[model samples]
Target: MYQKENSSWVKHADFTICDMLCLQLAFILAYWIKNGVGHPYETELYRNVAVVMIFIQLVCTFFNESFSGVLRRNMLEELKKTFEQCTLVCLLVLVYMFLMRVGSDYSRMILLVSYVFYIGFSYCSRQMLKKFLKNRRYEEGEKRSMLIVTVSSNAKNIVETIRKNNYGTYHLAGIVLMDCDKKGKTIEGIPVVAGSEDIISYIHKNWVDEVFFAVPKEITIPEQIIKDCSTMGVVIHMQLATMKSLGKNQIVEEVAGYTVLSSSIRIVTPRQMFIKRTMDIVGGLVGCLFTGIVALFLVPAIKIKSPGPAFFSQVRVGKNGRPFKIYKFRSMYMDAEERKKELMKQNNVKDGMMFKMDDDPRIIKGVGHFIRKTSLDEFPQFWNILKGDMSLVGTRPPTVDEWEKYELHHRKRLAIRPGLTGMWQVSGRSDITDFEEVVELDTKYISEWCLKLDVEILFKTVMVVFMGSGAK
Candidate 1:
């Protein structure tokens, strides 16, 4: 079911390598300019260090989202991300030097100059390349191949937007109707070739480069349609309630080994799975390394105050409705679960399924309040992440009891693995009093989940933890 597009992977690979080489050369030039006659030193150690540093920086640059959707990115956004990535690289270099105990070996002056020059030159290079590509595509009459997969008013609006924009780059290939009633007709001059059932056949027959889905959310097509399109090697775009409501940062993921249709902005990609796993491994290892030290200090304090186990384990719903034991530093009394029923009448929250009490009396003595407030209770979940029952970022898993109460729609949150921290946790854990709001946020996160989003959430999570905002 695969067909080739005008752009080839070879071209992409060549462009990627060229960009990397250009950046490397820019770094080298900056180094020379900064060090002058001492530029070409004969130290093998320095050369080895330089190679390793450059490789690490390049990888980090990619991870920080330096080279993504190069064609469609806005210049301003690209520049901002570039500046941030450059700063990150500089900081890494400083950290690397400190760790290696060789801060004196490398010239600080050279590093500073390289940082400035590399950032400016790299940004300019990307901008110039973007403009050049845009011009070339225009000159070559390289129109963006697009296929509309709906016959709704939303589809009409999408057509209107494409028409009004008049960028001359996008060419409407055809439209596929979600409902069979509109089959064998044309909408606004775009041919309605087939229905959702025949979309695979239609795509195979046509030279479609991109597929635009404007189908209503009520439609019950198998999620496989999106995955089929992705596996068939086409870029898929969907129109949600409003453009603003669309999380541009939502990630497209392959569910059940098939790519599901998702919004453009995502937290995880097939390409990023490796990096995410690596991060989980490294982060988990580091966390495990400190687990003993933390347990030692906190265990006795908790026992002294609460007279209970130092750790708490509870059954939480994980990916695919699976139940798993989640570990935490015991933040509540031994009989906290038993006391939940007694406090139900005093519950200030009113949500469909979730239970919450801002001022619950179930908390343990000294450490319970402190640990819960700072989210130190969640640190042990790093073991869960390491064990692959969870991730560094994903929807928060519900309690087993909570899972039993979930509606079918809410079960969609289990479509992906649960996380240690998530959008809901960072946004407003305690303040977000509505269970539906929590589910909505989770759905939003899943629909638009990506590695970048994970990174952003992790960053926000750090801020939230430090600020102790919305913690109970």
Candidate 2:
């Protein structure tokens, strides 16, 4: 599959971290220049101030997107951007000092000197890092290959544009001519590799990871070619750099060195995803600890009641249909799988896309009923969250058989990683019996996912668990 370039701060974190380091170096130098001190941060006052400054740096660099285009900026641009960011950090610190009435406690000269030194240090480091990154990522050797498709008339301009604005991740593999064969011909020295008829064959034999289509307004891309590329797991990005939003599910993204229209289930910033994953890791760690404790107390009782393994493992579909072994406390008898077929008639869901019954006959009566009611059966999934097979909040994972029976539309719910608790789980898990309603809630969660929405869902999940009403 075309490994979509990493979505977030992961791509440009080096510069952000380097800039913060530069500020620390600047502060150290400023301290020495002003007081000839051995270590400013060793003092309680300066140590506390240093911590606050670090927070300000985070706010300025990450939250404020100060390094949004760091890799693409030229030396002069980097100088301007870095200087502006450093000034902003100092200004925020100044406001903090003023508000706390501690202006007299801190040395103004040290602050001014730190700002000046930070601007110079950060700019140089950023420019050098950017150059090094461009060399390593784009020019060192082989990179992800990109194939450009367009009419012969538009080939030269599109090639020039891609070269000018390429994010340096994809090297031009060659071109494919739609209007006519220009095979063995070079547009801006990028050879025309194929023409309309043989493009698919050429791609089949080549290592093209992504395709960029930049046809004229009047021309249309062949549906067959698009399907052929997609079937081979190659992403086709249509050049739409000069336009604005293209409505729902259409995202304007920079791909293969060109701004293209990428259709996706959701479009969110890398920073937000970074934060979301961070939250998952933190929550997963805590959940695992609690799961261990709960298991100690619950496992023996479960074993005593059912006389089977305390843990249950089943292969379940995860994000994008990737399969993983999902774990839950053994909440049902050993023969539950075999018994499910006979029990299908009693399913609560109208369409039977999902299996839920009023009181599952297979549950190990007392212990199973208690765990399911308390939702403790799902605690083991915290390990899945840590492994990234799941998220803390997402669509419920369907059993392998249920997944196999799903219609095309139902697959959208699994576009994201399955979660321990989710929209449907929080929205009256037992009452909402319609599988379509489950799909609706899951898709709504995916489409409208944000930190705020996730927070609200998490809070509601806590309430639901405490109230003892979960999956029927």
Q: Which candidate is the best by lDDT?
A: 2
Give TM per candidate: 0.68, 0.55
Per residue, candidate 1 scores C-alpha lDDT tens digits across 1-472 of 3244433234345345555665566557766676564554356655755676567666665565556565567878878877877778778878888888888888777677777776787678777876666555353347778888875666677778777554466788877777665776677888777787788988888788888787776776568888898888888877653345654655445888986545543355555688878888887888777776788888998899888789999999998888899999988888999999888777755643777786678887567899899888888998999999898898888888778888887887777889988989988988988887888898889877667788899999999989999998
Query: lDDT tens digits, residues 313-355, model 2?
Result: 9999998889999999999999999999999999988877888
| Candidate 1, residue 446: how far the Cα is off, in Å | 2.9
Overlapping backbone residue pairs in candidate 1 total 14
Which residue runs of candidate 1 sit more than 4 Å off their true CA positions?
1-10, 35-46, 61-65, 137-268, 301-308
Q: Report the Cα lDDT for residue 39, model 1.
A: 53
lDDT of 1: 0.76
- Candidate 2: regions farther than 4 A off: 1-57, 60-216, 219-247, 251-260
